[model samples]
Target: MMLTIALPTGRVFSDAVEMIAGAGLPCDGLASPGRKLVIEAGEFRYILAKPSDVPLYVSYGTADLAFAGGDVLLESAMPVVELLDTGAGRCSVVVAGPRSQAERFRGHASELMGLKVATKYPRIADGHFSARGVQVDIIHLHGSIELAPKLGLSDCILDIVQTGSTLRANSLEVLEHVCDVSLRLVASRKSTALRWKEVQSVMNKISSHVKEKRP
Candidate 1:
């Protein structure tokens, strides 16, 4: 029986397809043009989902497995087995703002009171700030969080920093690194029991391929 997997529809999709194929699994029909939500590869089937929604698909057993960023999993609070860290799409979650603001944040818990922070990941942002014993107003934006600080819309921004180019271009500097993020293979708990053998085989193949490709 072929397993169903959820593939994220974005820049990482091609690399994900390559990884799946490297693991000796069928990985065709991923390149079909325009809004084709589902496709088949030999006996295997796949559903293309938004990066953020992949966890939801797997959690509800709509898709047996998925590949997505560790950040997404962390923010979604979904219950699933993290089968493997694919190590691609590497980035870091960070707290960043103007250099002058960095000095104020240093050991100054009272200064953070009533400050506005902008981010796409509100949950992650809230947790980070709350842990620091600071009260924050979260401005949730879907894209271009770097603009928040520059526009004076937010005093700081918590976001994924890939190369820090965007931050530097906007005169923002990384204040602190929150967590390292990469693509992860995640599966429903039911998948572990129902498809253990197949899952293990796929993981083993991918693991070997990853080891072989390492420099």
Candidate 2:
């Protein structure tokens, strides 16, 4: 059976290319294709989409399998099956702000009610604060989340920080660690039922490689 897979096209892209090749599913076309979104390797069909959109492709059954971040999966709440944790692109979703307001958030997040927060993950941010019995005015921003508190657009921000350098450059400090994010292998239920053995074979191959890479 021909298996369709969706992958994001950024940080996880190169790593995925390498991982898939190591797993005996060499996508030579994907590795070398220029200006092409779709690449086919024998019975495997691969589509490159934005990281956030990969889950959507899998959820809609447009792609049989997908590699997505736990952060995006939580924010989007797509109902696709999270089959395995790949552990690539490890990072944390965090609440941050300029050092000026550091003391305030450090005490009690809920006390700062109506806090102005900026984030790309509104759902995640809302859920985090709501659980603490706090309400916030969430400012939705696609990028440069570190600048929100710098420019007075918000008191704090919720964003994924792979390294603290960006926050330091922006004079922000992490107030709380929301959750750790990593790539995970996901499969559509239709794909699981229709091509169970094929999917298992690929998953098994990759799973073994993942175990080898981890300490």
lDDT of each: 0.86, 0.88
Tell me the tens digit of each residue's lDDT in model 1 across 14-56. 7688788887787666766367888888877889899999999
Candidate 2 ranges beyond 4 A from true positions: none
Candidate 1 regions with alpha-carbon error over 4 angstroms: 31-34
Cα TM-score per model: 0.94, 0.96
Best by TM-score: 2
Model 2 per-residue lDDT tens digits across residues 1-215: 67999988888887788779888896868887688999989889999999889889998989999888899899989889888989898899999887777787768766679999999999999999999889999999999888788788999999999989999898888988899989899999888888889889889999998888889
TM-score of 2: 0.96
Worst 10 residues of 2 by lDDT: 102-111
Q: For model 2, what is the alpha-carbon lDDT of residue 111?
A: 69
RMSD, each candidate, Å?
1.5, 1.2
Give the TM-score comparing model 1 with the true structure, all chains together: 0.94
